[model samples]
Target: MFWASVGFVGCILISLGSNIVRKTVERILTAQVIIMWFILLICVFTLTSMNDWIKFFKSLVENFGKIPPDISWWTLASAVCFIGAGGISNIWYTFWIRDAGFGMGSLIGKIPGWRGKKTSIKLSGYLPKPTKENMRRVKSWISNLHKAFWLVFFLMNFLAISLFAVLSNVVLHRRNLVPSGFEIAVVQAEIFQSVAGRFGYFIFLFMIAMLLWGTQLSICEGIVRQLADTTYLVSRKVRKFVKRDIRKWYFYLFILFAVWGMVWIVLQEFFSELIKPDFFLFLSANIGLISQLISLVMLLYFQYFIARKYLPKRLWDIYKPHPIRTVILLLTACFWGYFVGMAWMEKLGLLS
Candidate 1:
């Protein structure tokens, strides 16, 4: 799912960001998602032995020490910042717009009376009448409880990331801080203890690497699309050109990212000698989470401000009961939150 999303997102926003790092990252995600999935699926269905997988992966590495790995906690923390700041705020904006509706005033009333004939004539069967069912669903879905869900989600992610970071640190180190790149290589080197184990480990990492790429792509492409959409909204005249060329740019961007990811992987395969078995997975997790958090925050913000303008009337689909709403949101929020938070707190001595 993550790979697919990344590929889709990359394809959407390849041309917008000019920064080398930004563009490279986006392209890397695109490539990784596509390639990694293909390889993983083949391995899974083929019933290949884990040992052989690990050994085969080791043979691919070259020079493998440039990037620093962080825990998922950091990313989760960042994501929390986005959702709290933007997501809920926009949700409020949506409800507010609905509540405002057409105004009521004596002078205005007179105008309505005066213009009633003209207004009637203008609106005459031109628009569909609003219905009650959707409104009910919307009312049911967006509630205080849902707000709590996002809140919990953020908090849980924080906890999960933090917890894992702490644990990884303790289990691997004496000073209680994450190890350096050399140290990580040393630890990861354990996979090489046997060819099969090494191969299996790479297979696993390859899968995750692809997922990370997807998450990254999901976020960046989102930015590109929103940017383009915002441009169109700001001025309809730009729509024809933006619409015509944007999709192609989007797909190419993903392809570019996927290639970068593969390049990195290829390099790693080239230099498997200097690396040790010990690596900080937490760091990688954190990097991925950074994008997730940004998306979450932006999602909330857009839903309220820019998106509301384009949303039309079908958005109010909040029909779940308060309990169900709370439970569902709570579960969704906490699951990811705790999962992410555990990684961070573990690093910082904030969790068990």
Candidate 2:
């Protein structure tokens, strides 16, 4: 049943991936209803259990600025990486910005749907002329983009994470119950029910399922687009073969990924003894770290090489990189790189 459920999600995600961005956005917006319910649930949970909140705060004070012994380096790195969009996830924002016709991204055409009459797009787009008016507009658009990301994306994400952390600390940590596996939902549901009755149990489960579905769909869409875009850009032969319909490549790659996942599931079932749970945990952690490192490198390369070299000098006044931001990124990249190397060493049994 567990495997079937996983497969079911994969099927739906691929189906969505094959569709237009609008369809995916519609589903995402639908799933966002869960967030409203979550807010309500948390408010009720807090109001009903003021003592729990008090205890949670006290515990936070007690353990302030100290890492627990059982907490691993891998855990810390994963948290740092994932507190916002981790790895190549933020790269997908570029795709979205282009599709939404932000700034110079307006010149690049979006990925068309399988059913659309607008089915072809240029692999490369024309550059906007370095006109003063265009530069001003571009700067304004970029400023709005920054505002949207920091104000909407970052703030909402921080709030959601804060709420969930409070809930977990108040409920699970207080009871010394660690959340793990499929049964984690059931355990969480029980906790919610204790505060808000039977309806809360069902609400919790529904919200969790919605959250997971949104995440799975997002991964499917982002990765398929990333792979298809990269292939079309990098390989002239691939571009020649596909002509201009990268949508087919996106759909095909999604199917391929789904098949790969199914095969892994089968292998896990067959080699259940050999493939221990810790192996999967470490595998996930390592993949996250590596992807984060890759993204960091790409970001630096873009800032230093691509943007600095390719962008018109006349436009540099309006769109130059911020020194403080660049410095912070470099420092964070170094910090994450160190932890990633340590994680790899520990995984390879090199750590004494």
Highest TM-score: give the candidate number: 2
lDDT of 1 by residue, 104-207 (tens): 11111110111122111011112222467745544544554456456544564444344333323333453344556545534433432233366655764565
RMSD of each: 15.8, 3.1
The TM-score obtained by model 1 is 0.35
lDDT per residue (tens digit) for residues 1-352 in model 2: 3644484466545454545664555456555645755655664465437776576678778988676667666666566666666766877877877777787666667776565444555666766678878777878997998898896568877666756777767667778999776778789789888877988788777777766666656666678778888887788887678766776676677778777666666777788898665566556656876787778778788767887788778775567768897887788788779878876676578887
CA deviation > 4 Å runs, candidate 2: 1-19, 26-30, 33-65, 269-271, 276-278
User: What lDDT score is found at residue 94 in candidate 2?
Assistant: 77
Best by lDDT: 2
Model 2: number of backbone collisions = 0
Deviation of model 2 at 336, angstroms = 1.0
Q: Rate the local accuracy (lDDT) of all candidates.
A: 0.43, 0.70
lDDT of 2 at 62: 95
RMSD of 1: 15.8
